[model samples]
Target: MANNRNTSFLSDPALLEKVDKLRDLNIGQHVPLPQLVVVGDQSSGKSSLLESLTGIPFPKDQSLCTRYATQITSRRGDVDRVDIRIIAGPHASEEHRQHVEAFRMPTPSGLKFRQDFANILQKANEKMGLRADVSMANGTVFSEDVLKIEVQGPDEDYLTIIDVPGIFRTTTEGTTKDDMVMVRDLVTGYIKDERTIILAVLPSNVDVATQEILELAEDYDKDGRRTLGILTKPDLVLEHGAQAAVCDLIQGKKRPLTLGYFLVRNRGPNLESEDQSELDQIFRTQPWISLPQDRMGIPALKEQLGSLLFEITQREYPKLLQDVSSQISKCRRDLDSLGPSRQDEREQRSFLTHIAGVFQDRARAALMADYNSDSVFDQVQLRLITHVVNITDLFSAEFQQSAHLRHFQNPELHEPAEETVSSGEDFQGSNSLGLTISNLQDLLQATGVNDITQEELAELGEIIDLSHETTLPSDDVTSWIRDTYLNTRGMDLGTFNANVIATTFSEQSRKWGDMTKVYMSRVIVTIHRFIATTLRSVFPEEQSRRHLWSSILDGLLQRYKMAMDQASLLIEVERHKNPYTLNRQFADALSKARGHRITELLRPKARKDTRQYGELQNMVNLDDIAKAAEGKSNMEQQQEEIHDIVRAYYQLALDRFIDNIFQLAVDYSLLHGPDSPLKVFTQEWVINLEPEQLERIVGESKVAKKRRLKLAKKIQDLSSALKILKI
Candidate 1:
């Protein structure tokens, strides 16, 4: 066996072998890999440096000066073997990718690497769609496809190295402007990876400051921390009169680097020992002898590069582990989102049934205000009960503000209107109304009636403010009512006709239909949004969700229409039906309104008689009050009574309208009713679905299938990578 000491000289063979396995797992394509990459201008001895480090001869033709990136990984094993493959680019066509994957080179006996490797590379080039015989104008000169070479033997040292396309400033006959930009971009991209240790190869004959690779290295690694400068072609140093600057670079007196520089000369196909002797002899005679001995030869350069790569890998191990774990988690989530394959009726039905179960559970929970059902329900938008309640409250308030056709004011009772304070101005003309709602208690003091509760007074106040802007003046209302009563009067004689009361109430409440229609439409829209959001979460697949939505849409629309029709019917009953209420609150409201009006009329007389009677109520006795009320014409008093009846009926109907619209129409028809939207997709419903219908609702699309397959492969590769990392 080869000496174990040789393997230990570079890095732990065990660790490098694990890294080799990681590379073979192909995880680097997704994340940055810990490796060394050699970059330089064209014809700058990049291949030569790679050959010296790995003891493998690469093709010397300038035409192959990195038509594609090359990844060389060396490992120790029982049998000497060399295997080559191509990793297709992310955007490579499926047909071309298949060809690239199937490409193989037959290893000759004894592994004559130098003699046959050139033919292997040519075959790979052609496989990548690049042909030497084709001109640049006719064929692609470069490929993003990576050519990977694995060499394993008992004598091999463990290492991984990559050679990217050389950076060039100008394009030649075989290259175009696009090719120049492509090569530059490729090289910069490789060095930009923080985990990669840059091997910046520069010819000794070139001006070190003018080298593009050094500029690029500085651009990515400004402190020169991960960069190692390698000076090649030292034989041409004296002939090109570049010795002074080259010696300055070697001595680290100019353009200093943290890892510093290495001076190496190509071995030119000679034996390793002979090449070492010749390189040592060349450096021993001149100013090069003063250069550090540790930085002068290929053997020393290899040790530095191996140790640096080891240090970087050790430093970046945690990050690599985190990256792989994160990728695994992401791939798993993607796979879960795609759900299982649904190629047949059984699978489709199974998947959809599961979805329906979850959907029904969540929807039921939201409707019942049981938000603890799932984490998704924690969001306010998903709290269906709260959303509905809030909308209902807003509707109630707006209807109160905008429902009335005209507000009543007593034109007969003359009194000073006190200034009224209001919180909001949404109700118009309320401030200027003759009666100030806040002072109602003061006026009622003389009536000796305190039966009206604070809640009742507040309700009355709100109605008064909202009705301040009247569509008809008080006299006009009284005139209309008197005329209506006279025309519709029957043989009832002294009593006003019932038809007059109903017609007056109906005319005042005409705004109910339009307002209720808008409210129902809003409720329908809200229900639709909630259902759509729920289905999206359940189905995940766009096509499946769409089909399911279309299937259920007809039922939802029908239910919504029913709810709207119900609301319209309620409005019609309020607007045209007979005005009647058995609730005692209506009588109480009527009495309170009458007392307020009577007090206003009696205030002027009461103040004048205060000197004679000592108190207002004591001065105005019942018979005296009756004789004063007899002063007005009978028709005017009846008209006043008509106005009060309509006002009381309006307040009563407003409450009923609000309740009927929300509970009977919205809640019953759209939310929790028998045919409500919440009940559209049930376990029984899904069970009753035909096989073809189930497939249509839950079938996996081709795009989804393709994505699922892709994610599965990614997860497999990442899992293998994790296992190797753990090892």
Candidate 2:
């Protein structure tokens, strides 16, 4: 490594050009670029100082000219020539762009410093719509773009400067609120760069308290370490007792900066602009500046800046490489996350297909209830299962006790049944309640009594109350109880028809539609979820893809909603179909209930029948015992059949409806529908996309693409620069 202490080594042209190239690529806005940044309020001799440094009479008009950031860079070269260029900004107007483009193209005529450049700047204002007589009420001025001027002459100091727009207290005739803000932001953009050293220029003639640059500098660099205060227009400090204050300011007695201050005299407007030697002689004549010759002249400031920048560069050059590498890695990672650039048809095809396959795998997993998988739709599957289970369990419990199965529950209807007196003397009177099931086989052979009357069943529900006459034996007591229930067995007269069954389950089965809504919501949610996650991951620029996905999903979501509505409609249609309990296990349930009740009632401890061999067993009279047994048997059988019918009907109907409807929902719609997100792509759809449409889908915004390209180039350039650095 060369000794950085040597002035020649510190001022190496190659070393300084690395940062300049980054500036050209415009990487400074993102990653900090090491340079001297000049900032001051309007009329603070900012432009004069830059002109003195670069030896160019840059336009001094604040409103019409020099309103953009100007980068003046000088490198050591024998041919004293100037290279000028404009880096157009994202918001640059037509006028500014035209001028920039014209400047970029080669002219048949050789580059003329005076006329051609002046024409460009003037025409630029015209393009920006700045009036010859500018005013603020209807102001339209744009373009915060940079104008770069490079001067390379023999033994030129390797100094790079960022001269930004001047700050103003108030907008004048031509300037608006935006103009005021634009200038400040433009200046702040440069100074806020951590790697750039702030050259805070303030007129010595004005009070330093009013300077806006230092206030802004303090915001970004609070310690005032990177800030160097330059007191321009020192000649204007000839007022009453201002020279003493200026001298104190220069000597660091007031408003102290870490690098202190420099008092440089820009040539007064009336005087011919003096050369470097002439300025030195002029500065020596000044009372305030002559005392501190080392810190009062333009030459001294150049030396200080060169040393300062060199030291900063030497310290930060390695970090610059690291910063570039870090940004590059970030951009690449983001690009990778966007998957890949779907620029061509083939890439687009592959990108869309990959996303589709991923969505399909996830959707299939969800459908199969594979919650154990780490697929995106695992939670959806779990939630869906929970919903189905909960709804089915509730619906099953409800269906069992439905009103339509009431007669089935209580076997013999006991209300006003058809009454008839048989020709045979065995039949009851015409006015008797429902037909008696006094003899089961006879009722089955009927006096036309297929169903026992509700009246008869109610009448028979009564049990004869018996007192245990004179403390009879337990056998006698049990026998009496058995005989009582036997005499009052239930009778039913109402016919079990489709209307009765419909009334029973209509309310319960009506809720099948509600279940549709609930399950449909889950289905819709999962579908939407798949689309959202898939589309969101397709591109790094969420904003770019949002419009396209939103358009696609708008119609899709509407269709899905309609499909779900139709599902509800189909369920409603299913509800309107006459309810019927078909081929239910009525006989089996009746037999099971009868046996269960009879066994429960006639258990050994509770029975009153005489024992065959045990003498210790309690015995009732044989005739009474027979009557007791017959009575209990009849009562038990009648109740059993009713319980059996209700149980069978409930179980069958409940199972069928839930299984049929829920299975239909699971199979038919969302798992497959609004065409399923997986099948939403085609070769031509992704491939032959219009540019405008592609912009909505995956194409990068022009500004963002430009920024990425700039960063990528900067990385390449910085990597090349890193090769030149020995350390």
In terms of lDDT, the best-performing candidate is: 1
Candidate 1 Cα outliers beyond 4 Å, as residue runs: 1-11, 90-97, 108-111, 133-138, 239-241, 268-276, 333-362, 371-478, 490-498, 518-558, 577-663, 680-710
Candidate 2, residues 1-727: lDDT per residue as tens digits? 1234446645465667777876776667557878898888878888778867766665566545566677888777767677767776645555665666455422222235533655656655554444533454443554566777776767677788888777888877767798788777777777877788999998988888888888999999998889999988766667658888888887788878898898787765565556756755656664754467778688878888887778787778888878877776776665455455555545555665565465555545555667566544333323333333433333333332221212232222233122211111122322133333233224223222223345423322231111111111122322332343344333434322334333334433444554445445434444454455555543435665675565465455555555565666666655665644545465565566555544443443343544667544534344543344454444354333333443455455555655555555543544454454334543445555565565566555676565556555555755554444433
Tell me how far candidate 2 lies from the true structure as C-alpha RMSD in angstroms: 15.2
TM-score against truth, every candidate: 0.75, 0.65
Q: In TM-score terms, which candidate is top?
A: 1
Q: Which lDDT values do the candidates have, in the order given?
A: 0.74, 0.58
- Provide the lDDT at 718 for model 1: 90
Candidate 2 lDDT trough over 10 residues, lowest sum:
464-473
Instruction: Give candidate 2 misplaced runs (Cα > 4 Å).
Output: 1-11, 59-65, 93-99, 104-143, 170-178, 210-220, 236-240, 282-290, 329-355, 375-383, 386-390, 397-587, 592-727
| lDDT (Cα, tens digit) per residue for candidate 1, span 1-727 | 1133344535466666666677665577776888899998878888888888887677667776678888898776788888888887656666887889888886742268656877788788888889664254566998878888888888876678988988888877777899888878777767888998999999998888888889999999989988989999888777525787887777778898888889998765444456555765777857788777888888778777777777778778889889999999999988987888788888887787888899988888988989877888755556777667655654564566556655554433456232211111233322233333223324333222223346334422221112222122222455577787788777764568878888888876767666676566555655666677788777777878889888887777677778888888888888888888899988997897788777666655652345655754435556556655657776777777887788777778888888888888988888888989778877788888998898778877778777877888889989998988887
